[model samples]
Target: MALHVSLIDFLSVIPRLYPNDPDYFCSLCLLSTSSLCPECQHTHSTHSCPIGGLCDTHRFHIHCLFNLYVMLNMP
Candidate 1:
């Protein structure tokens, strides 16, 4: 028997290693050297917003994140 992988699984597991757009700065509050979120006290080096890819370029407090999703018409 052979193991099989789904397309969705492959897509989901791959991280966005390279920044695609220059307009979109790192959402994480980067450290002076490395990409890091100062808000999280640099605990999480990259802060991909919970809003999925829509607001990945923007970082917010928990409340702000919720409001932004609503404003942007994202579920």
Candidate 2:
């Protein structure tokens, strides 16, 4: 079954990614990439998600996979 994401989660990504009106989203249709929160011990990536290292296992879309990589690498 396909997972469902809410508008609030999608809306939250715009500020982190586009920071504007998300004009880029119009072109790509789907721009953000999602990942599970690191604090969760799930074997699969989608089982837990969103930022702040939540254990809630709620999937939320962030800007892109690149953002995830960037977040992971930061000091």
Candidate 3:
């Protein structure tokens, strides 16, 4: 499914939760991004779900992400 928001929208929400020093793994997906999810989509911010928290960085809407995860049998 296409995302409702753009990469910029995702980036706008990330910096505050993570360090913005341009040398950290993307907080949103455990990837390399100074400020953006590796797979950008409007997802739960790091506050709502940390790296090891429920619904972590999977970037679909909560319900949608859950459904996809189930469909794919992902952890």
TM-scores, each model vs. reference = 0.24, 0.22, 0.22
Q: Determine which window of 10 residues in candidate 3 has minimal summed lDDT.
A: 50-59
Pairs clashing in candidate 1?
none
Cα miss at 59, model 1 (Å)? 3.6
lDDT of each residue in 1-75, candidate 1, tens digit only: 323444455335424632445455554433322233334323232345332222244333443434433444533
CA error at residue 30 for candidate 2, angstroms: 12
All candidates in order of lDDT, best leading = 3, 1, 2
- 1-75: candidate 2 lDDT, tens digit per residue: 323444456446644653334233322224323243222323234424424311222223333433444554555
| Candidate 1 residue 67 C-alpha distance from true site, Å | 0.5
Pairs clashing within candidate 3? none
Identify the runs in model 3 with alpha carbons over 4 angstroms from their true place.
1-13, 32-37, 40-75
Ranking the candidates on TM-score from highest down gives 1, 2, 3
**Scored by CA lDDT, what does every candidate get?**
0.38, 0.36, 0.40
Stretches of model 2 off by over 4 angstroms after superposition: 1-3, 19-75
Task: Let me know the TM-score candidate 1 reaches against the reference structure.
Answer: 0.24
TM-score: which candidate is best?
A: 1
How well is each residue in 27-75 modelled by candidate 3, as lDDT tens digits?
3356423233343343346456433222233233344434434544432
TM match of model 3 to true structure: 0.22
